[model samples]
Target: MKASHFLFFILLLCICIPASAQEAKMKKIFNGKNLKGWVEPANKACWTVSDGVLLVKNEPAKKGAILWTEKSYQNFIFQADFMMGDGTVDSGIFLRSENDQIQIGISGSLKRDLTGSPYIPKLRYPVEATGVKDLLKPKDWNTLKIKVIGNTYTAYLNGQEVMTYSSADMPPSGPLGIQLHPGNEMSISYRKIMAVAL
Candidate 1:
């Protein structure tokens, strides 16, 4: 082959090789049979593998108990199917990285009765919760989708765009975790846990 033809071929091969490697890096976080690549947060008793889904039992916590992946993820799309009991069952999904972490999912339902009644938390603060999104359907399964690029995050619930948050403190690469809201007898299950790196 001529010099120019040989040079062109080499450059094309260089670009194609990396693309193939990138595709292999994306993997399903769950095996759909067992918990082989995941780690329970501080609470193991509340989280278990039942049948093919990862079940989160009702065990309240002071802050939030997490079920995070052992491996860290950078810019990727994380998807999971979760089920909650009532409007009382609150939870969160955290995307961790080296410096910054993005939190999504439903933590608690809208509680308007606490205002001017007795006490008020962040949810019941004087102003409507800014970071807080709308409530999810109670006692049913919901699909949460999170897309993280660099330090920015965009989240979706049940095929609807909920909110977008960005930060410099966000971790560029870290494990994905689910928060087990403290102080509730809540049971949640997660199936089809996966991450595809972009």
Candidate 2:
């Protein structure tokens, strides 16, 4: 063809290549059928899979549990859709380690919905998430997206940028975890759990 057309074609290919490569990096961490990649807890009855959604509830004794991934991740983008269930729904997504977590439902200590906020051990909530009051849907499904790079954590709720925090004490690498806060007698459902390494 013409020289100008050939040059334009090459430029388009360069731009499209990176976009396609990035999409391929994303993988489904949860198979939606079973807990194959996660480290199963002793109380299997507390966690269940139904209709491709992973449901978590407190055991009969009210003891909480954490469903953690077997593999540890460094810097990545994690996304999941969660629906708040019955009772005092206090749950979170633990990043890197249990020390740094993103609150999903009510805060046990604060006794209020702290959804989309970062909960750090010892330091508690260093900063509250903005627009969480309006962004969170009480009984419906909400999307949570977390981007982790080094010590900084950025959170998006329902596709809106909600909060960002930097932790000096965050572990460099650790497995991700979903928490069913102990003694809450709460329940939550999670689906479309995915992550992309950066």
Candidate 3:
């Protein structure tokens, strides 16, 4: 009805544009309600979710890895907050497929002397760890951020630079998986998993 009021309304609409645009650009891979389009390792009792958090109950002496998302991503930044327990736990965030590709995982504090097989990144990182979690408290939450671009990856744990390296050339596309290694009495929790495309 008034010019100044109209101008103020237009300004308000413009101010909200970028905020909504940013939200729209981000893709939430996990629904946080339940597992959908995701896969769990056969006979795995280690993975669960509560209070918007995915919980992996510690199981010992047998690998109980789980892969959460069915869809794959390339050139993205993945961020997750984790809380893990004792008894030397080792887990990883896998990129591209259940049967192929690289993984970013924990070493030391967890005392995981991981030996890789004929896996993709394993060929390049045989027995080498990309991340270490000594700074993470046994009973507290830790933040993790990983950047993946064309087989090159960098990971940060608890705001510390834990790893940075590049693997062999991959397919340039595929899904993502979350893995919980066996041989530890560790309860692992993950939430606020956010990813952005590059």
Candidate 4:
């Protein structure tokens, strides 16, 4: 083989390798059949799987729970489809730790729908996501996509970019969680829970 041809081939391989590696990193975190890859909450009855959907409802005690991933993720793209159910739905997706969360339903403290916004404990909500009020389908399935890199978070609702915020207090890495806020007789369903490491 010619020397120049060999060099060109090597360069092409270098570019393609990273792309392939990224694709391989894509994973379906939720198996749909059960919570195999997640750390089940203390009240297992609060979370259940039916027809490939992961459902969460308030327990009789009104004590909420958080379903966390068994493994931790640093930087990644997380996506899931959620359908709001009865009562005042209140839930969120915990980014790296419980402190940093993406609000999925109504904010308990705010007393309104703050979907797609970041809810930081103590700090509260630094910024609210726009277009959520118009894009959200209250009775139907809505897709929520979050990209977390470093300390920045960008949220997309139904494939439209809505909000981006940088957090100085977010941890470097931790397990992701799905929240079931207490004191509410509500239920929510999630499907197609996936993440791809960056």
Best by lDDT: 4
Candidate 4, residue 176: lDDT: 92
Model 2, which residues run further than 4 Å from truth?
1-24
Candidate 1 segments exceeding 4 Å error:
1-26, 60-64, 97-136
State model 1's lDDT: 0.61
* Number of the top TM-score candidate: 2
Per residue, candidate 3 scores C-alpha lDDT tens digits across 1-198 of 899999999999999986566546666666687776676666456767667888876655556666667666888777788776555556667766544433333453334433111135345343343334355455777777776778777667777765666666555777677777555566667888777777
Worst 10 residues of 3 by lDDT: 110-119
Q: What is the per-residue lDDT of model 1 for residues 106-172, given as tens digits with 9 covering 90 to 100?
A: 3344432111110123223222223223445545666777778887777667667655655645656
* Residue 141 shift from truth in candidate 3, angstroms: 0.9
What C-alpha lDDT values do all the predictions have? 0.61, 0.92, 0.62, 0.93
Cα-lDDT of candidate 2: 0.92
- Give a tens-digit lDDT track for model 4, residues 1-198: 999999999999999998678756777999999999999978999999998899999988989999999989899889899999988999999998988999988899989999999999979999999989899999999999898999999999998998999998889988899999999999999999999978
Q: Which residue window of length 10 is worst by lDDT in model 1?
A: 113-122
Model 4 score (lDDT): 0.93
